[model samples]
Target chain A: MIAHKESGERIDPTGIKIGMWLFLYSEIILFGGLFVLYAAYFHRYSESFAAGGEELDRLIGAANTVVLLISSFTVAASITALRLHQRRRCICLLLFSLLCGVIFLVNKYFEWGAKFARDLYPGSETLVGGEPGLNIFFGLYYIITGLHGIHVLIGMVLLTVSLVWVVSGRATAERYSMLDNSGLYWHLVDLIWIFVFPLFYLVL
Target chain B: MSNQSLEQQQQEHLLGYRQLAVVLCLLLLLTVVTVAVSYVDLGFFNVPVALAIACGKVSLVLLFFMHLKYEGAIINISFLSTVLFLVIMIGFTFWDVAFR
Candidate 1:
């Protein structure tokens, strides 16, 4: 390690953070594009969007929100554990966070499965072939939530990798950027869900 | 790499367990409040009110969970600029739609 440092190979946490922030910016922009579309369609079909929102299971949405919130907290606590050099605690917290992600995805699977059962897919007979407004509402719903589910999966993978590193003793307090970065990404996931939850589930 | 610099950095970045717990509680409380509020009919104010609550939740996550509050000016500027650009994109789109 000393040799690597002597050779100018060092971990710069600041640089890592800046890069992460830039990546997060691009992510926000990606989702922002979808928000623009949602705004346009909501303007065009206010009643349809409300109708579509009413069909969503608010209880499930609320449960998912709680799950993600707890996960975000655990991930943050994991980073705090890392800083304190409690590797075991950090790994445990990360595992808990990963479990929350799984629970979230499971809930999503059931939610989407139920929607599919009702023939409420994008081009399905019930939604797309029905009213134009319902078509757009459900279409946007699938695209946005599907994309967010993918992010949740990605965040789980990241936390899992960080957990493995912690177990292997690679992610020490001195070089914990991996863990910190994962926490940031997880927070981004939660942040997006905050908006998505309201736009789809609550703000009818 | 020195012990002193390592210690200094830790001092700067280390967050306490109690603080994190408090923030978590606050977030959970806000979640319940938002959901409860949604059950009412606030007319046009419903969307805006829900969104405002969501924004509050996001701010807490960004500041405490993501540690943006503890970070320096450069990172703050970088992240805020992204929000600015997002606002621009949404604002312009709304402008065009409203006009047309």
Candidate 2:
């Protein structure tokens, strides 16, 4: 029953928090489907999966891991800044997080580009002489990583929008639910990367 | 609206920074452990070890960085349900793929 002095707005923070949680739940399901697909194909092509995974540059993956971990920390700090009502610091941290996301996508671009140059675009194109295991492995690789890259792209856009809100004064310390929710979403993006890094790059 | 200064509010909020730093350090340690353990020829234990470390890191992030520890039970329940549902889906898919 707290009232806003300026516009006389009454807010229920709990409701919005729950709404974000629900949204996150749906996202988990979406990613879960892709994970299942990956697991199925991995089981089918254990050796090829390992071999194809070796083709991936571990250094790049590891660098991206550091990048994302740093971004996650920045986003966490941003949320703390928001709660502390430090508007400038919050905005700066959010911008830094978004920049990190862009760097991740750039890395992904090079990784996928290398695969494409090798004529590894999944499906029949992925197999040179009908190696079923390689075919299956590449197929799952494209599907899972492709979908994940798209999600990261979306997250970048979400973070950019939040940054814009902060710049425009639409998001403030007292009414920063949007920023908080977006931070959660960004953290999830980073978390997914944490799993993806090990699964795709280090498992071999 | 009574009287607390903005600086005081900011300082109070930063009180958790030390705890966050500790968790971050732990996460880094776990990451190193996961990578180092991966090099060992433990057969099936390799993936399990990596996954265990990953789970531990995730727990730290959720409980500390995300402030889930201080949040209401509703948030915890919601997150748990999400994880549970994901497990069920993954299990079903595993069964279908393994048997077929």
Candidate 3:
């Protein structure tokens, strides 16, 4: 506890984690609100939801799932690197995780691009004239996955900042809560995708 | 008696790279299994089955990757309550939809 003192007192890692968990709770509830909509629509329109889901490329979805899962691994391992006093390994691993994030967003870009090309967007001419259930299904799909994609981008920034700190020695073994917290945030992104993958791509 | 060193606190629960690699492999395998199972048409059991596997993966990430397993009860209690309330909220919403 020789470092990271505030007002002559050592800052508590547990307290910072608690604050992060509280934010995560709010995040859970935020997504829960969307899940509730999904539940209602899923109950009333299983057929259309299935149809909309069928339009999704499970191979791509599965690929992104693998990508995020690997990113989660690299991010976690980066923390392990930090703990072992392997600063260069930590930086390399975080860079690898950021690469995965870019890969994810690129995949998402193409996926959404294909959809937009087909006018599969909300209130678009093609989708608007289709079954109301399909419309609702894609609506929820875009919103949920769109929001999760944003989180992925946010996570990349967090990891990048942490990477800078680690490189500059601001985030060291003695005081590396930023790296730990960034890892936690990254895992939460992975956690949400664990649900998102199946609900949209698998359960068709 | 109350002055446990920060180094000791952190080092006590640090995970090895081997453990992280194992968890990663298991998660990837479960992803494969879940995708494979989806093609089998498990009827009404499909969603629940997929979700159960996802839950297993989530637990591994939380316990190992997030280090919740080594954390104190305050953090555990807070995190668990979030999941608990999420379940309650989703359960009640489904209940209302079911009977209404």
**Predictions in order: chain A TM-score:** 0.95, 0.91, 0.96
Kindly list the per-residue Cα lDDT of model 3 for residues A1-204, writing each as its tens digit: 234555576777777778898898899899988988898889999999999989999999999999999999999999989988999999999999999999999999999999999899988997889899999999999999999999999999999999999989989876788999889999999999999999999856
Instruction: For candidate 1, write residues A2-116 as lDDT tens digits.
Output: 2135558766677787898889999999999999999988988989999999989999999999999999999999888887888889988998999999999999999999999
Q: Candidate 1 lDDT, tens digit per residue, B1-100?
A: 5986765664357778889989989999999999999989999899889989999999999999998887878889888888999999999998898789
lDDT (Cα, 0-100) at B38 in candidate 3 = 84
Task: Give the local distance difference test score of model 3.
Answer: 0.90
Off by over 4 Å in 2: A1-5, A123-128, B1-15
Best by lDDT: 3
True lDDT of residue A127, candidate 3: 84
Worst 10 residues of 3 chain B by lDDT: B1-10
Against the native complex, each candidate's DockQ, computed on alpha carbons, is 0.64, 0.40, 0.68
Least well predicted 10-residue stretch by lDDT in candidate 3 chain A: A1-10
Model 2 C-alpha lDDT per residue in residues A60-163, reported as the tens digit of each score = 88788778777877877886777687878988888888888889889989988998898877644558566787777777677777777787788788878888
Give the DockQ-based CAPRI class for model 2: acceptable
Which rank order by lDDT, best down to worst? Answer: 3, 1, 2
Reference A-B contact fraction recovered by candidate 1: 0.81
Off by over 4 Å in 3: A1-9, B2-7, B10-12
> Clashing residue pairs, candidate 1?
none
